[model samples]
Target: MTTNRTVQTAADAALWLAVHRGWHVLPLNYGTKTPLRGCADCRAENTDHTPQTCPCLARGDGALCHGVWAATTDASVISRWAQRWHTSVWAVHLGASGLLAVDLDTRPGPPPRHPLNGLPWPADEPPPVDGLDTYATLAALSGGTVGDTFTTDTPSGGLHLVHEAEPGRWKGSHGKVRDGDDTVRTGLGWQIDIKAYGGYVVLPGSTSKAGLYRRSSTTTTPLWRPDWLADALARTGHDRTATPAKATSAPAPVATGGRSGPRRYAVGALRSACTELAVMEPNSGRNRKLFRSTTRLAGMVAAGWIDRTEVETALAAAAGHAGLPAGEIRYALTSGFNRPLPVPDIRSAA
Candidate 1:
């Protein structure tokens, strides 16, 4: 993988890949916007959630890079985006940055906020020049009254919107802290920047959006990959596949949702899975707490784990996996405690 290039970020490249692959995902708000917490001073006008995580902290910039990651089944989409940007797997980073900048500029609210009160293209008027490059478009926006202008974001989180003309020469990371206790392990990140936008038969002649670019991380080395990122990427479809370049004697873990470990085999796995019934439970926290007591699961009542009414409350208070049904239990273990997971019989247990 080649490295060393201009304005690159992990998130930018990932999202860009999705866009190129004909996939578009939700974007997260970073550095504090509205509705969303950490993004306090988002566009500050029409604060919205875009799907980005701050990567600045990883850059040792003492901050996070606020951007989003999109989803897709096409593994090659990311690669293709990176290639278009003349970099590695980093188009997502570029795409996100470009979008965030646009988002910040266009946050919904009445004017006169003094910061980012103007629009890149007037609501009534249209883009002065069609197909402007990312830089040119930013320059126009930052040019005052002609384009978009982001003025004031609370400095507390480091969410100062940079102009396309004045690219901050940014040397730091995001302004937000991570959401989990477990450290995120990263092997390599594809850094990207919004270089330009192009090719649009449908993009209105009045609509002017530029493309983005990204490069592999060469400025600084990425940390923590062997344990967490390796699994997260494959499991989440971030890397698509980690096929080995050379055959090794050691076996690789199968990408199955869950596995059967030695010395631990439960009966009724198929029956539990086939008939397992789960419900959606929403939550927000540093760590995800399973809410079994609060909601009654299909097998919870039959298994005698708890009363139907007590399901929601029990699940909310649930800590670790002990004994739920095989399917429910495994599903929970695999995907955010989807529902109660336990084997049918415990020989003589509650």
Candidate 2:
């Protein structure tokens, strides 16, 4: 396994790992939500582009804002979503233009011809099923990295190893650019209601070649949009540790914790998964979306959009460490779904 120090080049390895594990790498715009959902006036304005001002609110009288940054990385969000939904992140396709985390472990076959797609592997070299193993896989893949790995615990009784990255100036989502349109959730709006930004853009074969900020991006800080080489370099934040291996575990079960229906598992399952995937507690807008997505996925999984096998794996992977069981999970999902069920005394299973 690669350490955080090499995250700068582990993109390829990350992609390979993701593909093998079953995550669909997609590249949708992260903050493309526009107020266009309903209120035309709510649509984000291009007046200044960046979040410095709220274009979403034509006659705004407050600080400029767009969608809130996602509390978790693309990997964690999808990972949790799959577990709750009884599906696998691998089942979906991830797309992005700059998730560079490839490494020697992740090999490329050929040069990329499309600006949006990733480079191809050598003709003789087929894409690895988690196959590509090289020294530079970190940046080669789209996995983010910092300097090194560290163990951290959350309020929820979950242990995890995560990747950290050099604090390269993270330009807030379309904060400076007045693209007029932003975020996929609201569409053509500013303030993408930062609170609603649920997911991150993950393109499997994309490129970071394009500068970080564009008319489409939410980056606004001088650090993110440095005016000069020094400014850019100076603004770059360092996340020395990237790709820390999470100790993926589950929360301990409580008495009388099981659900009472066929689907009561949704609440516990969602809770367990959330405990494992979350780096920070679900507090701010970004975390709120994570929590919501976790619930949505659990309900979706029970509804059958997810395969049983995938659902089990995701839940186990995230919560396995804590040794949480199906009964507890059942309770969590049941509560999360809060739907009617015929199965009574299910919670008694204990």
Candidate 3:
């Protein structure tokens, strides 16, 4: 196993650590957070393919093509990537790895007038200046101090509080809170970003232009995020009530037998599938459900009963809502689309 082998490079070490910790990871551009670009074929505008349908990925080429979607916990894949991008920086896919990263960034400005609505800063004392202080303030308001956990100091003098969580339980969000188009207030206080579902974080032992990401806490095992803190984050950090964005335009519906029977059935099937997927929990085989749903929808697409773009967009949104990351959804969709369509039972529509 790659984890048992002697580390050859910094990338190898990082990959090994990820494997050992059972975290899904992908290679980033050396010394940067950017994901490596796709193969030339994938980048070509003439080729109509997605990360899921890419020939190179299908062949197990270990090509860094689809950004975080290419992340894997598979040891062999990580080994191949480590040997190839020996100097690459590795990033943990927080959602896929069943973790959440609380990022406290450093800022250079006066503190906000009100960081948290109910918890105001003392007028007699100095205000909070950076993320760390803001986080501390939030913690105190939530009825606890910042407890020890798996913490890392970022190159830019920020902190990452790594916590264990079920994947897709929370969505990633920026530090600042917004009400429609206007800024309402700082949610988890200013500069404290929540990195959860649909996000990735640079791992420790990685170096960037600024400096190295070093461990700040002695704790090796990450503590379960405190209930109080989780409650605060749910209230302030995550915008769970917001609706998922829909595609701007959809493909024209394919004509079905010069009638709308098949198209109508397909539309109904898509809606049912999406409704089922949206409410699934992380431990409920959500990925498998997503794959099965995609396969059913793919059969409809292949039969020309519906538009592929519409199916793809709706399924992606549903899977995303269920807490699967964008990459995982694409992978599942690709596999489902490529597989032979199961025998369609149109008796209901008939």
Model 1 per-residue lDDT tens digits across residues 1-350: 33333213433433443455332222222212111122333332443533342233233221112322332324454344334433322212323233212111122222221111011122333322211221233334333221223212221211122223212221221111134322211111111021211100101011111222212122221122223212222321123223323212222211222233311222222222222212221112211223222222434444653344333323322322222223223333333323344434544432
Q: Summarize candidate 3's per-residue lDDT along 257-346 as a digit string, tens digits.
A: 325777778888888888787777654656567777777888888888888888888887777777665655776687677653654777
Which candidate number maximizes TM-score?
3
Output the better candidate (2/3) by lDDT: 3
Error of 2 at 40 (Å): 4.0
Q: What is the lDDT of residue 121 in candidate 3?
A: 49
How far does residue 91 in candidate 2 sit from its true spot (Å)?
A: 16
Cα-based lDDT at residue 144, candidate 2: 29
Model 2 over residues 1-350: C-alpha lDDT tens digits? 22322222223323444545433232222233111122233334645454334344333322113332111125654344323322111111111111212111112233222111112223344333221121123123323222232222211222111222123322212111123422112111111100111223322222232212111213211121112211211111111222234345443432222333434455455555545444342112222233243455555555643434444445444432433233333433333344322322334644
Q: Native-vs-model 3 lDDT?
A: 0.69
Instruction: Name the regions of candidate 2 deviating beyond 4 angstroms.
Output: 1-39, 42-45, 55-162, 166-350
Relative to the true structure, candidate 2 reaches a TM of 0.19
> Best to worst by lDDT, what's the order?
3, 2, 1
